[model samples]
Target: MLFDSGVRSGSDVAKAIALGATAVGIGRPYAHALAVGGTDGLVHYLRSVLAELDLLMAINGYPTIADIRRT
Candidate 1:
C-alpha cells in the first residue's frame, strides 16, 4: 500500500488520497495538538480535520473515498 507523509491539513490528505495513497502520516499535527492541550486538544484537532474533509467531499460531490480517487 502507498503511504504519504508531511500531511499538514485536511486538503493535503484529500490530495494524497486522490493521488492513490492508501494511508497518510499525520504525526506532526498530532504532536503539536498534544503539546498544546493534551488529549482534548488532540481530539479537537482530529475532529476539525475530519470536518474539513467532510465539507470538501460534500462540496465536490464525492460521496466516498473511492469517488475522490476517481477525480
Candidate 2:
C-alpha cells in the first residue's frame, strides 16, 4: 500500500508505486475536492488524478500498474 498526504499529481502516484506500493488509497483530497466543488468536483478530481497516474506510467515505460517497481 502507498500512503501520502492525499496525492495531488500523477507523478506522485507513479513514484509511490516505483517505491513499492501495490495499492493506492486516496483520502483528504477527495473531501477537499468535494468541499470546494461538490460531488461533481470530486469526480473531476479523481479522473484527473487517475489520468495523471496513467500518463506518468506510460511515459516511464510502465504499461501496467503491476510493472511498476523500484528503479
Candidate 3:
C-alpha cells in the first residue's frame, strides 16, 4: 500500500500498515518537525507512529506487522 500521512496522524500509519504497506514514507510532517523542533520532534513523531501501529496490531489480534492483513 502506498501511504502519505505527513499532515495526518499516527492512526493513518497503522491503517496503511494494516492495508499492506511494506514501507510508509512520512513526508511533510517530518520535514516540518525537523525544521521547527529539530531532531527531538522527529524522534517523537516516529515513536508515536510506531506505538500507534503496535496498538492497532494488538487490537486486530496481529502478533506482528507481517500478520497485519486487509479485511
**Candidate number of the best TM-score:** 1
In model 3, residue pairs whose N, Cα or C atoms come closer than 3 Å (at least 3 residues apart or on different chains), thus clashing, are: none
Relative to the true structure, candidate 3 reaches a TM of 0.74
Cα lDDT tens digits for candidate 3, 1-71: 57666525666766777777767788987887888888998888778877877787788788876666545
Overall lDDT per candidate, in order of appearance: 0.88, 0.80, 0.74
**Which candidate, 1 or 2, would have the higher TM-score against the true structure?**
1
TM-score for each model: 0.91, 0.81, 0.74
Q: Every model's Cα RMSD, please? A: 1.1, 1.8, 2.2
Question: Which of candidates 2 and 3 reaches a greater TM-score?
Answer: 2
Instruction: Kindly list the per-residue Cα lDDT of model 1 for residues 1-71, writing each as its tens digit.
Output: 56557887788889989988888778888999999989999999998888988899999999998999888
Query: Candidate 1: deviation at residue 14, Å?
Result: 0.5
Number of clashing pairs, model 3? 0
Candidate 2: C-alpha RMSD to true structure equals 1.8
lDDT value for model 1: 0.88
Q: Model 1, which residues run further than 4 Å from truth?
A: none
Q: Order of all candidates by TM-score, from best down to worst?
A: 1, 2, 3
Q: How much is 51 displaced in model 2, in angstroms?
A: 0.6
